[model samples]
Each structure stands twice: as C-alpha cells, then as structure tokens.
Target: MTPRVAVFLDYQNVHLSARTAFLPSGSSGRHGHVDPMRVARRIVRGRRFDGELATVRVYRGRPSPDHQPVAARASDRQADRWSRDSRVVLVRRQLRYPKAWPAEPAQEKGIDVALAVDLVRLACEGAYDVGVLFSRDTDLVPALETVRDLGCHVEVASWKGTSRLRFPDSQLPWCHYLDADDYAACRDYTDYTAA
Candidate 1:
C-alpha cells in the first residue's frame, strides 16, 4: 500500500535558508530564488514515497512592502501558481512583530506555531501515513513526537548546516532527517536575487 504523505512547510525559515545558502553575495546580484512549490515537489520526488501527496501546506507570514520588492513578487507568483495545482495548499498568516525591528531582519513569528498546530491536528485526524516537515526549528519537537506516537512516519527536510543542532537528538526515534543539499542539487544559483 502506498503511504499517504502530508507536507508542511515553514515558509520564512525555508525561504531565509534558501536566500542565505543559495544566493550569491552582492547588492546587485539577482537573487537565485527557487519556487517553494517546486522545492516541495522536488522533496517529494526525492523521498520516493509510495502514496500520492495527500496534502501540502505552506505557512508564510504576509510580506511587508519594505522587504525586497522583486523577491516578494516572485514568491507571490510562485505561491499563486502552487495554489492552482491540485496537490498543494498554501496557508498564510501575518507576522506578529513588524515594528521595532530591523529594516531587513531574517526572522519572523507565528510560522513555527502554525506549522506545529497543523501537524498535530492532521496527525490526530489520521490524515496521512507520513508527515514531512521542511524546517529545522527545535520548537517542533513536541509536534514531531505526537505525530510519531500516532503511528505516522515523520521526515524533516532542511539545509545541511542550517538546521538547529538540538533537532536530531530531540526528535522521536522513528523520525527521519534529510539534508536539503541532498535534494537541492538541480536548483543551485550562482547569483543573488532580491526578495
């Protein structure tokens, strides 16, 4: 029997990692931004899971205009495209803190909580046989444990050196960890693009 897989993505974290890890240095460089949906598809393919994709939920905070305009546009376009696809679902929430922050900070709020809540809810509902998370936040440890206890397999996909150090040891024994570099080979970029 093919396993049903549910994929949950932490948009800000994944995007930040991609931007920092893959994009080239320089203010004028075209940011090499890979489509998140495309990245999700690539992850699914790399996982080689048996069942069809049961659901794909991407969690992102609404973008502020002060952020990189071009990159933001590209991300919106990609997300719009993904929403039209049958296999993917986009879930968005506003970042809690915008004021009193740097003009261009790398972090955001609410994504981790959103991901965690959805992961546990879906697992408890028996929505999927496999749960895949594209983030490295140690805050998700409890959610991972709950999903595993529900008899669903959990796999985490993240950049090689970008993930939280405590994640590996904190995860349940059955949870699997996949380094993003293993799956990002085809999407490498030599230049940075503003986002």
Candidate 2:
C-alpha cells in the first residue's frame, strides 16, 4: 500500500519566507502568495506517495474585520480559494490587535499550538501514514518527533539551504528542499490589486 500522506502548511510562516526569498528584491510585499494546492500537489508528486492525500491543512490567521481594507481583501481571497479546493482544508485562528495597532500589526497568536496539537492528535488517530510539514519553523519539531514516535513517517520541506536544522536524525523529520522553480510555478497569480 502506498503511504497515505497528510500535508500541513504553516501558512503565514511559509508565506513570509517565500516573500523574503522568492519575491524580487524590491517588488514590495504584494505578490508572494503561493498556491497551497499547487505546492502540495508538487510535493506529493515528487514523493510518489501511496496515491492518497488524506488531508491538506493550512493554518493561518483571519484578519479581524477592522483590518486595513486593501491588504485584508487579498488575504481573505487567498483563504477562500484554499477552502474551495477539494483537497485542501483550512484551520484558522483569530488575529489579535491592541486598541492602537502597531505599524506592522499582530500575528496569529495560537496558530502554532493549534498545529502542534492537530499533528499529534491526527498521528495518534492513525489518520495518515506520512505527515509532511511545509514549514521551516523549528517550533514544529517537538510535534514532529511525537508523530514519528507514534509510527508516522515525518518529513519537512523548506527552501533549499534556508533551514538551519540538520534532519532525518532521531530528533528531526526527514528533510527535503524546495527550490526556486517550485516557488516560481506555484506563486499566486495576483497577490495584490493596484490602487
């Protein structure tokens, strides 16, 4: 039997990294959203999985209704698109902000904890034979270890040379690197609308 695979995306984590590495040096932060579905399909294809995508879960923060109008639309559109994909599942948390928002605003407070819980819970429940994390955040390491110990094959994907982790060892998941071409192909067609 081919390994049943579940892909979990740390949406903001990956998005920020992609923006830093894939966006042209000075193009502004407008167009770096990668199609999560495309990203998952390409990774699964490369792995030659057991032919099942048990789950494609993306974790992110839903901007509160009062967020800046323009940027929030793009974020909402991206989330909506992902939710509509037959193979993609979205797990979102609320974004928190102080009464007086900072210049950069706030990030999703509980997303990592939610992801970690789900990863371990799903693994224990036998939801998949393989758990592949599309992230570089070391915060996921403990959960990955627990999943591996529970007999799930754990793999992590990141931009080539971007992760400082040395993996496939007893402590970390087996590692794979995503290159520039992958990002170029999966990047969002329209990440922003001109004002």
Candidate 3:
C-alpha cells in the first residue's frame, strides 16, 4: 500500500531561504514567490509515496499594502490551480503584533503556531500515514515528536543551501529531513512561472 502523505509548508521561512540562498541577487521576483503547488508535486513525486495525496497545505499571510498587487495575484493563481489539480489547500492568516513591544524587535505572527496546532491535531486524529513539514524551525520539535510517537512518519523538507542553519538531528532524531534543492532539480521553473 502507498503511504498517505500530507504536506505542511512554512511559507515565510521557505520563501526567505529561497530568496537568500537560491535566487540570484537583485532578481525581480520575491524570494518565496515559488509556486506552492509545483513544490508540493515535486515533493510527492520525490518521496514516491504509495497512496493518493490526501492534502497539500501551503501556509502564508497576505502581502503588505506596499507590495505590488501583481505578486499577490500570482500567488493566488498558483494556489487556485493547485487546489483544482491536486486538492492543495491554501491557508492564509494575518500578521499580528504583540502588545508592549520592544523597540526594533522583529515582528512575529502567522503560520508557526497554527501549523504546530494543526500538526498535533492531525497526528492525534490519525489523518495521514506520513506528515511532511517544509520548515527547519526548532520550535516544531515537540510537535514533531508527538506525531512520530503516534506512529506517523514526520519528514522535514528544507533547502540544502541552508544546511548550516537546518534543524539539528539532536532535536528530532526520528524525523527525516529532505533537501528541497534535490527536489527542485526535477522541476522546470518555466512551467510554473507566471507570465
């Protein structure tokens, strides 16, 4: 029997890493501007999972008003296409600021907590045979462990370019980390590029 796989992506981190590590400096497109559906397909194919793909959820936030509208449109289009073709789900959350913030502190909000909560819930509910996480945040170690203990395989997907900053095995020994670069090798950028 084929393994039933569900993929959860941390949109911001993956986007930043791709921009800083993969794309050339001074490029026009935003760093995480990749087609989530394409990435999902690449991952599923790469893993050679046996069962039908149950879900591919890409988590992201709305763009700031300052960003060009075209970018958001492209993202939505890609998401819609994925939803139609492969049951890909797009989760959008707003960025929020904490009260009594320190001066010059980085803003934090969106997906991380949501992803963690969903991962635990899904694992406990036995939603899928395997869970694929496209992020390297150590914050997820607890959730990863919980899922693994529940008899679900948790695989980490991240770019090889940031191998130095990738999650250490000491954090979650049972989980497997997949290099996104290796998966990207099989994709054709032109096919997913928005005209």
TM-score between model 2 and native: 0.88
Q: Residue 35: error of model 2 in Å? A: 0.7
**Where is model 3 poorest over a 10-residue stretch in terms of lDDT?**
97-106
Over 4-46, each residue of candidate 3 has an lDDT whose tens digit, in order, gives 7888888777777666666678865543356666666666776
In order, candidate lDDTs are: 0.65, 0.78, 0.65
Mind giving the per-residue lDDT tens digits that candidate 1 earns over 74-100? 556666766777767777754444455
Our model 1 lands, by Cα RMSD against the true structure, at 4.3
Q: Against the true structure, candidate 3 has what lDDT?
A: 0.65
**Clashing pairs for predicted structure model 3, backbone only:** 2-50, 2-51, 15-32
Measured against the true structure, the TM-scores of the candidates, in listed sequence, are: 0.73, 0.88, 0.72
Clashing pairs in 2: 2-50
How would the candidate models be sorted by TM-score, starting from the highest? 2, 1, 3
